[model samples]
Target: MATLTSTSVHTSNLFSREAIAEGTMAFRFTKPAGFEFRAGQSIDIILLNPPETDEEGNTRAFSLVSAPFDPDLMIATRMRDTAFKRVLRDAPVGMQVKLEGPSGSFVLHRKAEKAAVLLAGGIGITPFLSMVRQATNDKTQHKIYLFYSNRRPEDAPFLDVLKEVARQNPNFHLIATMTQVAQSKGEWKGETGLINEEMLAKHLPTLQGPIYYLAGPPAMVAALRRMLINAKVDADDIRTEEFSGY
Candidate 1:
């Protein structure tokens, strides 16, 4: 766990909200003056005067989807039928929300000499999206390879933006896979299968020195960690953040 030097809380109004994918929404909020956070960090969010609450509480931690330079604070999540998510999903513009502590160690190492292999499952792509956007905007020299898995294109969040980023940033490569192709609709051209050693090898021929970042459901993260270890990736070189539930 990374320690935060400051845990000061701030309040901001919801500037806008829109659906980015099925059951997922992208929210932009007013960025409090002097409120700063790294690209991959997460903040605790509390809906002020939420409509409902349960054993899960009224607050949730979400990765900052917007870059540090962006004027608005942004976060995205699947709109589950839970009370918290429902309140957030239907939250009106101008609603106030509490934010605290931009904490988390799941950030880019800024290693210019080494490559970064990012493995994301479903909504786990949030933090990686921020990092990749920052890297692309700054034109960082660090190479990045993103392997994002989802049921299909419609269920995958930020697919279009990521593809555009890959196109704009020569150092950034995207390998999007669909695990449930049979149930997916429309034309599919990308790879179809669960992420495995063979897929990694196919995209990353020489993964000896590259750092690995895994984010997704607990089971997926655990499985990928085991796969990477089996593939001889150094344990110290891999950093992970697990998103609970599917």
Candidate 2:
């Protein structure tokens, strides 16, 4: 699939920042005039005149978490102790940043007849969240199955939002699992353990028909891809995007 050439760049100010999960934060930025992007896209945010610098530099790429119809652009990440994250975490509401292209081809399949099976781990749910939101808003006919795995309920970002989305969109099915729910203080009753072929078979009618989308750390993405391939799903139907982290 061809990706959008991100030639457009704009200067935007931070709108708000809030913690949505344990050690995770969602940052909203004012969208520049005439700026438009697909649901599953990413952008490079360049910090301007930071108080400090590091080997990672000032630019970081983040998936767009906010839907296209949202009032602003948003990105979420685990707040590490890195210089960039620290700056972003403490950034004033009106701080300026350079917003680069809405790059990446890891988007939803348009065929309404075929289903979309999304495998997301940790913070990798960003793009899928945008896609689900847009689908609900547009009243799309495509069926979506989201299998989101996290360490714990507290560790899962946007869990409540996704549950609400599931309630609002009948075409959207969410199966959120926890790999280490026992370690969490909060109560969880959903499926537990790493997402596997058996779990998928229980929820999905058949894995071979739907297009699969995977996103997460390198290891998780590779494992999910291998699982799909091992299940005899067509390799041509699998698409993946690995989040190396900011």
Candidate 3:
């Protein structure tokens, strides 16, 4: 568990934040003072407090949604509790918060020896967002497949941006699924089930030479890991980041 003790060099909140998704907030820490990290990495946020912890007694963990060379530190967060939800949901312009690290072990392989298949569930799309943003920004010719799952069309973060990426970039393939569509609009025509082996095979029939990066809730990660293994995806080729309510 990392603490909130930033060394002052990495603290910056001069940018704005917006609600990109229903329960998600995206902040642009412009040229974040001392924040330097890989595109697929994440960070820890230390909320202001009076020494009293929340019911969970934990800080927040979020993934960087911007590329490393974007000249700004972009992190997307999912506010799931009263404490964080209140702060993020009601955050006005110019509000400041604490953030640290470009943390995490999940990143795009730089050696060019391994390709990647990124799997994201709902708000878990943060890390993969960074990877895609980096790759797209750099115009790298890597074969990447992004499988993003959400409850419905409206729940999917960066929906339009992803569709545009898929439209413009042949190196990226973005597929989506909606588990429940009670609130979905009429424009959605994609799949409507949890990510499964069959879905993977259907979209990425040639899953021969790519690694897998999975990020999402614990249950989604666990179930998807099992399914990937059962589908003969090498365990070593799969990297996961579980959002455990930290």
The candidate scoring highest on TM-score is: 2
lDDT of 3 at 161: 86
Residue 188 of model 3: what lDDT?
69
Error of 1 at 192 (Å): 1.0
Clashing pairs in 3: none
Tell me the TM-score of each prediction against the true structure.
0.95, 0.97, 0.87
Q: Output the TM-score of candidate 2.
A: 0.97
lDDT of 2 by residue, 1-246 (tens): 225765478999998999999999999999998788888888999999999879989999888999999989999999999999999998888999999988988888888899999999999999999999999999999999999999999999999999999999999999999999889998999999999999999999998999999988888999999999998999999999888762
True-structure RMSD for candidate 2: 1.6
Say which candidate scores most in lDDT: 2
Off by over 4 Å in 3: 1-9, 50-53
Model 1 Cα lDDT, one tens digit per residue, 1-246: 234455668989988888898888989989887788887888888877787888889888888889887789889898888998888777788999899878788889877779999999889999999999999998899989999999988899999999999999999999999998888777789989988889989998576789999998789999999999998999999999887646
Q: Can you tell me which runs of candidate 1 are displaced by over 4 Å?
A: 1-5
lDDT of 3 at 114: 63
Which sequence of candidate numbers ranks them by lDDT, best first? 2, 1, 3
What lDDT is reached at residue 151 by model 2?
96
Candidate no. 1 TM-score = 0.95
